[model samples]
Target: MFRVIVRSSISLAAFAAGFPLSAAEAANAAATSEEDSIVVTATRAPLALDEVPSTITVLDKAAIDRSQDIGATELLLRTPGITVSRNGGYGTTTSLRIRGAESDHTVVVIDGVKLNDPAASGGGYNFGHLLVGDMERIEVLRGPQSILWGSQAIGGVVNIVTTIPEKPLEGSFDIEAGSRNTVSARAAIGGRTGPLSWRIGGQSFTTDGISAISPAFGGVERDGYRNRGVTGRAELALASNFSVEVRGYYSKARVNLDSTRADTPDYAFNQEFLGYAGARLDLLDGRFRNRISYSYTATERENYGPLRARPVSLEARGENRRWEYQGNIGLMRGVSAVFGAENERSQFRSRSPDASLARPLPPFANGKAEVTSVYGQISVEPVDGLTINGGVRYDDHDRFGGQTLFAAGGVWRLPTGTILRTNYGEGFKAPTLYQMFSQYGNAALDPEEAHGWEAGIEQHLFGRALTVVATWFDRTTTNQIVYTPDATCNAASTNPLCFEPGSTTVRTAYYLNVARGKAQGIEAAAALTLGALTLDGNYSWIVTEDRSPGGANFDKDLPRRPRHAANASVSYALPFGLDIGAALRWSHKSFDDAPNSIVLDAYTLVDLRAESKLSENVRLFARAENVFDEQYMTAYRYGTLGRAIYAGFRGRF
Candidate 1:
C-alpha cells in the first residue's frame, strides 16, 4: 500500500505538471516580481522566479532598511497573505500565520538551517526573539511545501538569507532610539580574502514596554525587556570545485511578565543557539553538484516568580540534530533534477513547579523522536516560455510510521508581459513531544495532514511600470490537534491525564486529535513605480473554518484569523537625496476564542517615515508609528503599542 501510494503520487504529479497551462497557469511565474528574480526556498535550489511555479514574496535589502522595523515579524506583517498576533509588546509571545494557517504550520529557515523548539507550544519557533539585526533578504513561500521542506511546512516557509560581503573588507553599523526608553545597537564587519570568507556580527536591544494585559482590562503595570545576540559564518575554498562552510547563531533575552489581569513579579529568560558545518563538491565538470551538512539547534527557557515557594516556575530545554546530503544534476539545457536525504533527531525535557508545593521539585518529563526523509524534484522546459516541475518526498517517523508527499506546478511567461502559474502540494506533521508528555498530555494522538493548491496571474503593463498579481489558494487539513477542556477530570478520577505517576493534582485540559481545518483565501497585490515615486498595496480575504464533526463552532471562523486584511504604502524620493514614505494597515474583526463568545474589533494603523543621505556611507532616518494612537487588540485584552516616535542612523563602509 505504501509503495502504491508513493508511486501514484509521483505519477499524478508528473501528469499534473504536463497538463496545459490554462486555468492552472494561475500561479507565480518568473521570480514573483521584476525587482526580485531569484527564489531559493521553492525547491531548496536557486531558480529564477520566472522558472519556478510557486507563489513567493521577496524583500530585498532596500525594503528592509526603509521599514525600520525592530522586529522581524513586524517587517513580515505588510506582506501579502500574512497576519500576526502578540500577547503584549516586544519580547512577548508572538505568532505569525500564513494564509490563515496555524502559527506552527509554517517553517522558518535561516542561513540554510531550520529553527524550532520541541518544548514550545505547537513545536514552533517564537518570532518574538527574531529581531531585524543583520538580515539581508527574506522570502515568503505560500501553501503546503512538505515535498521539499519535509515537515512543519503545512502552511508555508520563511527563508532568511543574511549578508555575504562583496568586498575584501566591509563594515556596517546602526544605532536607533525610540519611545518608551527603547534603544537598539548593532554592528557587523566581514572580509573576503583569497579563498576564505568570514563574517561576525552582534546586536543589543532594550525597552521599557507597555503592560502585557490591556489597560482597559485592569492591567496597570509596566514590563521591560532586554535582548542580546551574535552571529558568525565562515566559508573556505579548498579547491575550485570543493568548499567547506560553518555558521553559528546565538541569542538571549529576558522579559517581565504579569499575572492574569493583575501585576506580578514574574519574568522569563530565554536562550537559543544554532550551529552548522557543511561541505560542498562538484563532479562531472560542474554538471553535478553535491553538498553534505550537519546542523544542531538548542533552545532553553525558564520562568520565575519571586514570591513563590520556588523561584523557578517552569524550565524547558529542546535540542535538534540533523544530517543531510543533497545532489543536483543538470541533465541538459533547461533540464535539471534535485535529490536529497536527511536524518533528524529531536528531544525535549520540561518541568513546572507549583507555587503551592513546598516539597522538592519533580524530575523533568522527557521525550524524544526521530525522522528520516528522502526527496527528489525535477524541472523541465519542454517549450519556449513554459516551465514545468514535479517532486516527491517520503518520511519515516519513529512514532507515526511513514508518510509521502507530492508537489507539482507550472509557469508560463509570455512576451506580452503576462505570466500564469499554478501549484499543488501535500503536507504532514507529527505530534510534538510537549503535547504527549507534558503535565496534561495525552499520548494517543495522531499526526496532522494537509493538502493545498494555488493558482495566480501576474501582469506587467505600460513598459513594466505597473505590476499586478492575484492568487487564490485553498487547503484542507485533517486529524488536527487541539487543546480540549475537561473540567470533570480530577485527581481522584481514573484518567491518567489528571494525575502523574504519584501526584494528586487535577488537570484542566488535554491535547487531542479531533479537529479538522479548512482555509481559503484570495490575495491581490499591485506595484506602480513612476520615476522617483513608488506605490505598493495588497489585500487578502481569508476564511478559515473549523470543520470537526459534532464539534462546537464547527462552522465558525478560526479564532484570531480575520476575514479581511489590507496594506498600502507609498514612497517618494526628493531631489535633495531624501526619501519620504507613509503606510496604512487595516484588519477586520475576528473571534477571540474558540467558543466565539468574544470579538476583537477591527482597527487601522498609519505610519510616516523619512530618510536622507548624509553622505555616500551614512543615512539619517526617523519614523512615527501608530500616528493616531489607534487602540486595537490582536489578542483579546492584550496590550498593543500606541503612537510612538523613533530615530536612527545607518553607516556602511
Candidate 2:
C-alpha cells in the first residue's frame, strides 16, 4: 500500500512539472508588488511583513491550498528556514527541529492557545498528525520569542491561523483518494449576520501504510494510520467597544509504529485526542485587546513486542488541561504595550497493564503540575525609521520552581533601502513530568536556560523587485541534565527489582546539575521577482558544542542537528489563470545519538504543484511530493516514505 502511494505521488509530480508553461507567460514578467502582503500575527498584531524586524514566513491561503500534502508537517516543508523531522513514515508524530533547537523548545499555537501536552514526559507537540487543509494561514517565527510569548519560546514559534468567513453562508468541501488506499475528506462552513459571525470544519483521513522494514524483533507488521476531527468557532460584536470570538477544535488519531529494527512483526499503536477553546475581546476604548483560552489533550499508548519469548507490553494513559488569559494595550501613540497573566494546571496517570512485568498489576506513576506567568512587551519608535522593542516575563512552575526572561531589540532603516536590526533575549524550558518522576529516580531536575542575541540586515533592490536578509546569532545554555551510572545493581541480587539487578547494571540515569552547550549560526534568505515568476530561497549554517555529564565527553555535536540546510522554490502565474510551481528541499544529515556516533544520510526532495481556474468559482489542482523516490531516514534508525501524489478540485461560491 505504501509503495502504491509513493508511485502515485511521483506521477503527480511529473504531471505538474511537465504541464505546459506557456499559460503562465503573462505573469512571468519581473514586475511584482509586496505592499499589500499582510505582516503576520507573530508580532502579536497585524503588521506588514517588511515592517516586522524579525525573520518571519507566512504561508498564505493560496500556498496552503496548492501544497501537495494536507498534513501540517508536510505543508511546512514548503516554507524556508524550517525543517520537519518525522519519527518514521508519514502520519507518525512528525517532530520539528528549528535553527538547531530541540523539538520541545519550539512552541506551536493554534488561534491564541498553546498546544503542548503537560502530561507527557517530553512536553513536545507533534505536528505530524495535524491537518492543514482547513487553515487560513501558517506563520513561522524564527529566533527567540521568550519576551513576546513567554516560556518554551527558545527556538521559535509556528502559529496555525484558521480561516474566517467574509460573507454570510460561505463553505468549501473536498474529497480525495489516491495510492495506499488512502482517502480523505475536509469541509468548512462560515457565515455572518448582524454583529455575529461563525465557522465550522471537519476532516477524516485513513491509510494502510507500506510493509514493515528490517530490525524486526517485534511481532507486529504492516504500517497503517487513521485520523478524524472537527472544529467550530464563532465571533460576536457585542458593542462598539466590545467584541468577542470563540473557537473549539477536537481531533483523534491512531498510528502504527515500527518498533523493531527489521520489518518487525510487532507495531505500537499511539492514540491521541485534543481540544481547545478560546475567546478574544476588544476593550478599553480600542486601546486594549484581551484573549482567554483553554485546551485539553489526552493520549493512550500501548507497545506490543517480545521480551525474550514472554509477551512484553506497555500501556499508559494521560491528559493535560490549561487556561490562559492575556491582553495588549496600545497607548501613547507610537508606544504600544502588551501585558498578560496566565495559569495552567495539568495531571498525568500511567499504569502498566502487562502481566509480564514483576509489578504489572497497578498504576505505577501519577503526577501533576501548576504553572503561572506574567509578561509584558512594549514597542516604541523614538525617531523616524528607528523602532525599539523591549519586554520581560516571570514564571512560576510547581516542579522546576521559578525563572525570569528579558529581551531588548531595535531596528533602523538605512538610507539606501536597507534595514538593520539587532536583538538579545533570555529563554528557559522547565523539565516535564517524565524527566522529574518517570521510571528514572531523578527527584531533582532543574529547568534548562539560555541567553542569546542576533544582528541582521535586509536590502531591497530593483525598486522592491528583489529582497535580501542576512543574520548572525550566538546562544549559550546551561544547567543541562546529565545521566550517570548507578553503583548498586548486581546479578546476584535476590530481589526481583534492584535497578537492573539481573543484568549486573547498577547504573541509573538521572538528571544532573552538570552539562552546558553553545550554538552559533548564520542565515540568509532572498526573494526575487521577474515578470510573472518569483524565486525564493533560504540557507543556514550552524556550529554546536556540548559538554556531556560526568565528564564523559565535552564539545560534541548536538544530536540530530545538521551543519547546513537549505530550501528553494520557483513559482509562476499566468494571466489566463493557470499557475505552476516547483521546489527543492535539502538537509545535511547529522546524527541521532548523543555523541554523534550514528549517522543518517542527507537527502533532497523535489515537489511540484499546479492549479488552473476552469472558471471564476471553480479550479483544478494537483501536486507531487518526493518526486525522486529518494530512500531516506529522517531520524536515527527509522525509514521514511518514498513518494506520494494528490490531486483534487476546489471552488468558491
C-alpha RMSD for every candidate: 7.2, 8.0
lDDT of 1 by residue, 1-653 (tens): 00000001111011011010111111222214444443546876645657778788777667888898889998889988898998888998899999999999999987878899999869998998998888866778899999988799999988776665546899899999999999999999998777877779999999999998889887778788999999887778788778888888899999998876776779999999999888878889877878888999999999999998778999999999999998888899999898999999999999998777757677898889999999999999999889999999999999988998999999999999898999999999999989888876777889999999999999989997887889999999999999888888875787776664335667778898999999998999888888898888889999999999999889899999999999889999999999999999999999988877889999999999999999999999999999999988999888989899999999989
Predicted structure 1, TM vs. truth: 0.94
lDDT tens digits, residues 242-314, model 2? 5555566677676666653655545455566556655556667656767676666676665665442435455
Q: Estimate each model's TM-score.
A: 0.94, 0.86
Error of 1 at 566 (Å): 0.4
* Every candidate's lDDT: 0.83, 0.66
What's the CA error at residue 567 for candidate 2, in Å? 1.1
For model 2, what is the alpha-carbon lDDT of residue 215?
24
> Looking at model 2, which ten-residue stretch has the lowest summed lDDT?
1-10
